[model samples]
Target chain A: MSIKNEILKIEHLHKAFGENVILKDFDLSVKSGEVIVIIGPSGCGKSTLLRCINGLEDIQSGKIYVDEQPVIQGSKDLYEIRQKIGMVFQSYDLFPHMTVLQNITLAPMKVQKRKKEKVEKEAIELLSRVGLADKKDSFPRQLSGGQKQRVAIVRALCMHPEIMLFDEVTAALDPEMVHEVLQTMLELAQSGKTMLIVTHEMSFARAIADRILFLDEGELIEEAPPEEFFTSPKTDRAKKFLQTFEYSKK
Target chain B: MNWNVIREYLPLYIEALGLTVKIGWLGIILSIALGLVCALILYFKVPLLQVIIKIYIELFRNTPLLVQLFFLYFGLPKLGIRITAQTCGILGLTLIGGSYMTETFRSGLSAIDSIQSESALSLGMKKHQVFFYVILPQAISISIPGFMANIIFLLKETSVFSAISLMDLMFTAKDLIGLEYKTIEALFLLVVFYLIMLLPVSLLGTYIERRVRYAAYGD
Candidate 1:
């Protein structure tokens, strides 16, 4: 494989809410087309890290560089920076008032000022890609949970973002619905989209991640190829963590 | 009790109804505008303006509309601020109605979940765009029921315009009674006209509430 350029870099990040420190001195970097899965126990800053990258949450004392541009909260360029990063949430927060096509086409036409015809055409294509073409005119209340999640993915993808952030996207789905959402994500990963995923689905993480990052207590405890990390985790924390998944699987 | 007296006053009652509706509509529009502005200010916490709006809401909401109309019409002229009684009626109604509207809109805005805004922002929308395109629509939908109630309340409040001598419905009734002592006829006409003015609005509110609820929740 040819060498890829780094697209995202986080250095010496510190984030806290009031007196509670969530992330301390956290550092990470991702190259183009790299799929990084962040796996950790709850409250370990997995979701917070993604939020910081998207400029949703403010950081205390660190810098995040996306495509060499700083992601500063309240900056004039933050809107431009956010256009390059697409984020999908766990709750699939589709705007309840708008139909699926309206929800998907809203930002591209309004924020980016793209042509309505072009944006609608592109939205329909993406919807078909997610197998939701027939449901385009339906409101969010009409769709099933898995279908809403897929439509949300199409909403994010409609921006043509350079990097996509998935924050526990399938954690809220029913058991049968999780597969469809995960399958859509797997296809996205296969298409070489740079993705940072925070998930509790160990098997899905192992299947799609180029590198698996183990985080505990807001620290990067270990990083390795998925095969190595799953087979022979270096730290006792990783070992114990993987064992819980193993026990749950049985 | 006298059908002849009611028949004799029909034209006068019609003219009074027209004036009452005109004033009611003007008051409703102005109060909604004022209320929306104050609500947005408070919702976004616009520095010093938010503090002023809070005081304005408390003052207007606590005081009776009658007192407010008296002050605007009777008291302001003594201070060299001579607005017409018509202006006083509309202005006073707006002041009190605006405060109620502000609370109504504020509750609507607050009821929207933060995640909705977050979703819009993450899609690369600016703060204002998020507010206009995403937040405001949902907020307005959530606020339809309250907005309708405020409209009806403002219309009812228009009856108090007679206190300022603006020739509204109540003034027409009181004038007819004082002139001819047709207490039953005048009061009966007043009741009928008020129902005519307010019934459609009340019914429209219910219709809109149902439509908005169905669109939002499919219920």
Candidate 2:
């Protein structure tokens, strides 16, 4: 655990929709290059947590810091914080109108105002990193689900984000396609990209995560190294959770 | 069956057809602009503009185009501001066409997932950039069919401009009838003129709709 210097910190965060409180007094801190994976049942606010960190959802009350810069609710510009953070959704949400190359180059060229030729060169390099260099001219519709998600990862990486948030990036893939997408993520994690992932893939989580956070119904129930969490979970909820996977596997 | 009269009036009919096409094309362009502005304002839920837009959409959509045309052509003159009949025609079509176009665009905008904007925002893009880059293209793709269909409706509705004496195709037919007493030939040629104008536009709309649908929905 050579982790030092926190990259993200959330304190006393509260989020809700109407009378239904989704997250309450939740807090977390992550160090640079720490691959934190979040596991939870459906509707347990796992995705909500990632969205809050990225400023997709406005927290009811709390403070979030990215490298000590506070993400204030309305006053601070989210663009500054978001530029360093990239998010990939379950659906890929690729801009269908854009070619793979254009999708990768858009935010960098448009928002960052980088020169087109330079950004496009970087985009091509990222596409090759994801093994999709030949698919640059293809529209999203032309790609299979696995290829689309891979391209999506490349699209985010083109922006040169310091941190990445992945919300079930492989959940929608066919069983055969899931591996390809996960392989891209595995390589990304190995490259030391700080990531906060909400996923159901236990095996992948075990392989890459530095720390695993178990959330149950809007509360952090357990946080441990993946080895310890898998072998000896501290809470009954986490035990039952691991049991379900065990039962499913058997 | 008055062939000679129709032949004699060919130039007048052509002139009227040209006027109708000019007014129709200009009005459609203006409406597209107005509709986009109004739709964006409503989509963003601008505090005051939201209520005003709702009233505007409801008002124009509910009432007849004739009433709207007359109001623009005749009603404004009574208020001591006189505009040309042609201006009234274009403005009337723009207002009415704009209302319908707004609704079409609204549906298109709503069809997109809010997550799309969220994704763009999380990528460090500004709100306007999110709109221009992420949302507007998708919205336009989905809205084109509806917008094109509305253009045909707007084209036919230009007949109402004749009420304000703007001398559109319908106006020429009516005038030629009065002069030559060849009502059937005049009216028949008018129908042919409208069909000639409308058929190509309708075909182009269908072609574009198919292409856009394939791009957006992958169907």
Candidate 3:
């Protein structure tokens, strides 16, 4: 594969909620087809960073670029920017009133103005890809946590985004359900889709992340290749954070 | 004891039942519309209007429905707004029922997970799309039971319309009692007519509530 240019970039991002600063001068660059995993302690601004990139949350001061277009503040055209990025949330926020098929086809049919038949065909294929073909007619509540998360992923994928952001997508699942969601993500990573994942699953991160970003106290403390970050973390906070997983496994 | 009197007054009672149903149905529909508007204004926190809605909800809810009916029926005519008694009854029921409907919808809107809206927005859906397609549907689903309960309550509230001489079921029964002096037969027939009117409404509400829940959970 050829070397790819940056598909997403964030610079000097500052975010705060009610006098409590969440991110300070945060910077990140994501190249096309690169998989980056962000790991940090809870409330360390990991999810906030994902939210900012997608414009789900506003920043105190910063710039986020998707495909060389600057994010327009509170602009109606922001949907143009958002369409290029697909995001899966921690809680798998599928539209409960809709079937799995409806959930997947909603944006395509409504925003993209695609033919319902075409989107339905594409949705079915995507569902089949995620082992959820049988669940196309089912509602979100009918599915288990892992099934719901996988459907959430496919729902984003239906938009044909150039980049995907996963914000601790497996954090809410049962222990047994986590593996299925991780496996679906691993398949997407191997397919060369650019991904930004925020997760605590160290082993999955090690397997997929091109670079692992360690955020601490609202700052990116270290960024390293997954192999090096796991083998010998450069910062004490990263070391201590990793050790919690290590002890749990032991 | 007064079977002959009951038979004689059947047509009048039936006419009154027809008027009551018409007014009750109109009251429920208007209240739902007004309630949704009030709830949406409050939910979006529109400036100036939200406070007005708050006052409207509180003022109507705090006072007695009879006082409101009396004002609309008698006092409004004193101000030269001479509408019919039936119109006054509907307006009265709507004002009171709408207040409770607003509360029901507000609670339902709150029950929705905020992430549902965020997820829709992140998918590139416009603000209105996020509301109509995502937020409103879920909010309505969560609040359907409450909505049904309010409708049933409003249906029963139509009994108060008799005080305004609207010729509703209650008024007809009162007239029958006055004519025949058979209070037991009049009250008995009145209870049966109310049961006939309200049972179908309650059953329909339950059916819709079940479907909404099923759509929400698929179970």
* iRMS (Å) per candidate: 1.3, 2.0, 0.8
Quality of candidate 2's docking, in CAPRI categories?
medium
- List residue ranges in candidate 3 displaced over 4 A: A1-4, A248-250
DockQ of 2: 0.62
TM-score of each: 0.94, 0.92, 0.96
lDDT of each: 0.92, 0.89, 0.91
Predicted model with the maximum lDDT: 1
Q: Tens digit of lDDT per residue, candidate 3, span A186-228? A: 9999999999999999899999999999999899999999999
lDDT of 3 by residue, B61-126 (tens): 899888999989989979989999988988998999999999999988888888999899888999
True contacts kept of each: 0.73, 0.72, 0.80
Taking candidate 2, what TM-score does its chain B reach relative to the real chain B?
A: 0.93
Q: For model 1, how does the per-residue alpha-carbon lDDT over A1-250 read when each residue is reduced to its tens digit? A: 3324778999999999999999989999999999999999999999999999989999999999998899999998999999999999999699998999999999999999999999999999999998999998999999999999999999999999999999999999999999999999999999999999999999999999999999999899999999999999999999999988764433
Which numbered prediction scores highest in TM-score against the true structure?
3
Q: Candidate 1 — which pairs collide?
A: none
Report lDDT (Cα) of residue A139, candidate 2. 88
Pitting candidate 1 against candidate 2, the one with the higher TM-score is: 1
**DockQ scores for all predicted structures:** 0.67, 0.62, 0.82
lDDT of 1 at A173: 91
Ten contiguous residues with the weakest lDDT in model 1 chain B: B210-219
Model 1, B184: alpha-carbon shift in Å?
A: 2.7
